[model samples]
Target: MRIAVAGSTGLVGSQVVAVAKAAGHSVVGLAREDGVDLTSPVGLDERLAGVEALVDVTQSPTIDIEAVKFFETVAANLGDAATSAGVSRTVLLSIIGVDRVPQYDYYVAKVAQERTHRVHSPGLHVLRAAQFLDFPGMAIRWGRDGDTTTVDDLLSQPVAVGEIARVLVELATGERDDDVIELAGPRQERIVDLARRLVAHSGEHLTVIARDVPEPMRNGALLPGSGAIIAGPTFDEWLSRQPA
Candidate 1:
């Protein structure tokens, strides 16, 4: 099968491309680095020519209305071009808690993205995934203020990015009855705790503090349902491999 991956160099998309290619599939990379921008994209149909499956793992750099516009445009562009190119399968990567966090701007944007895809690509399959295991590191880096780092006191089932990528590739080529699938890590964990552990592991002279967030996230809104597929390198297992 020939697969085209949008955001082909991103965290998850890159992995998806690697997995597909390693399995002996041909790949067409659609990304800005390759002179293909999904938003205001040119020659998208040409790029997707002969692509049997397409995986959208594109990301927005912002979280406000701008983010909403970014996703909406990208989804629409990809859907139309894929349809024109006769792509058989389309898979979109989404966050697990997007529907649960109605008030959050980024979540709202994601919902809009999904809505656009559903409209333009009727056969789209969405893979809603839990927070990535490396999220704690990102949080700490973003929350840094002097020697203190503040993180949301949120519950999360942090799945490995590689595992998420593997499943996405499978969905692109395999048959499934459902339009949506949820995936998560093996265990539930606190984001703040993970941040503290990460700080300790890195020997960083920083204080990790847990701050309050909305009740939904603090409670369990981001968790996957019983039907969700669980995959690993549990957080600790993934962390152990990180260099100090």
Candidate 2:
């Protein structure tokens, strides 16, 4: 199969590309680094040529109206280009609870992306997964620098990025059921605990204060529901592999 992965350089997309190649599939990478901007579709038609499937794992850091517009544009461009290229299936990586709860601008953008694919490309497969275990590290780095606060009480099930990538490849090679598949980590842990574990793994001491994070930033919806697929290595297992 000829697979084209958008945002192939991102944390998750990069893994997807690796997994696809390891599975014996021909993979093409499309990203700004690869001279294909998904938001504009400037070189999409040429890049998507001979692509049997497209996995969209693109991301942007916009907020408010800008975020929504960015995803909407990317979705439109990808859908059109994939259709023109005779792509049979389109797979999208989405966050869990995008439609269940009222999240910030980014969630709205995700909803728009999903809707665009549904209407424009009916053969789309949407996979929703929980937050990555490394997400708390990102949050802490983006937050303050002190070691006084610990945020171990917030609920989250952090899945490994590699596991998510493998599942995506599985979906890519299978039929597109046009249904949403939900995946999560093997165990549930508080955000603070996860953060602390991550910090400890880095051989650093940092306090993760759990405050009333803004609703847009809170990942309450990332938790798995009853009977939802709980896949991938546990957080502690993944943490143990981190370099100190």
Candidate 3:
């Protein structure tokens, strides 16, 4: 199989590239670092030539409306280029429950991406993944204010990035029976707790604070459904492998 991974250098995409190659598949990395601009890609069709599947793990740094424009443009470009190049499958990695959080700009942007891809991309498969296990580190960076870090008090079943990547490759190469599939970790946990543990494990002096979010988030909207696939090491298991 010949596969192209958009955002191929990212946390999940990189793993996908590695896993696919290890499984004896040809892989192309579609990323700015790899000389492919997703927002306004030039010669993208050439890059995707002979590619059997294209898995999009792209992300926007912004949490505002700008993210909406970024995803929409990239999806349209990828969809068109893949069609022209005769790519068989196009997979999009999305967040679980993005539709339930309209008030949040990032979630809104994700929903828009899903909608755009459905319209433009042929053989589109939506893979709604749970929060990553290391997301607490991101929360610490995003919410940091001197010595204090604020995080959401919401619950989540955060999967490992490697697990997500493996599943993405599986979905890309296997038969496409479902339009949408959700993936999550093995157990539910509080985001705030994970943040505090990460801070403590890292020996950081910052105090972790919990903040209440919107109702949907607080009421388990971010959690994967019963039909979702669950696989990954627990936080404690993964944390033990990390350097203190």
Q: Model 2 over residues 1-244: C-alpha lDDT tens digits? A: 9999989999999999999999899999988888787778777878989998889998876656587778888888998988888898889999877786554566777898889888765268888988887877776776555765544354677788987898788778884353688888978777766777777778776766776644533646657777556876888777787788
Per-residue error at 47 for model 2, in Å? 1.1
lDDT preference between candidates 2 and 3, better one: 3
Report how far off residue 65 is in candidate 2 (Å): 4.4
Cα lDDT of model 3 by residue, 65-129, tens digit = 89999999999999999999999898999999999989888999999999989887878988899
lDDT of each: 0.91, 0.79, 0.91
RMSD (Cα, Å) of model 1 = 1.2
lDDT of 2: 0.79
List the candidate 1 regions with Cα displacement exceeding 4 Å.
Answer: 175-177
lDDT of 3 at 2: 98
Q: What pairs collide in candidate 2?
A: 149-207, 149-208, 149-209, 150-208, 151-192, 151-208, 152-192, 152-193
Ranking by TM-score: 3, 1, 2
Candidate 2: residue 94 Cα off by (Å): 0.5
User: Which 10-residue window in model 2 sums to the lowest lDDT?
Assistant: 213-222
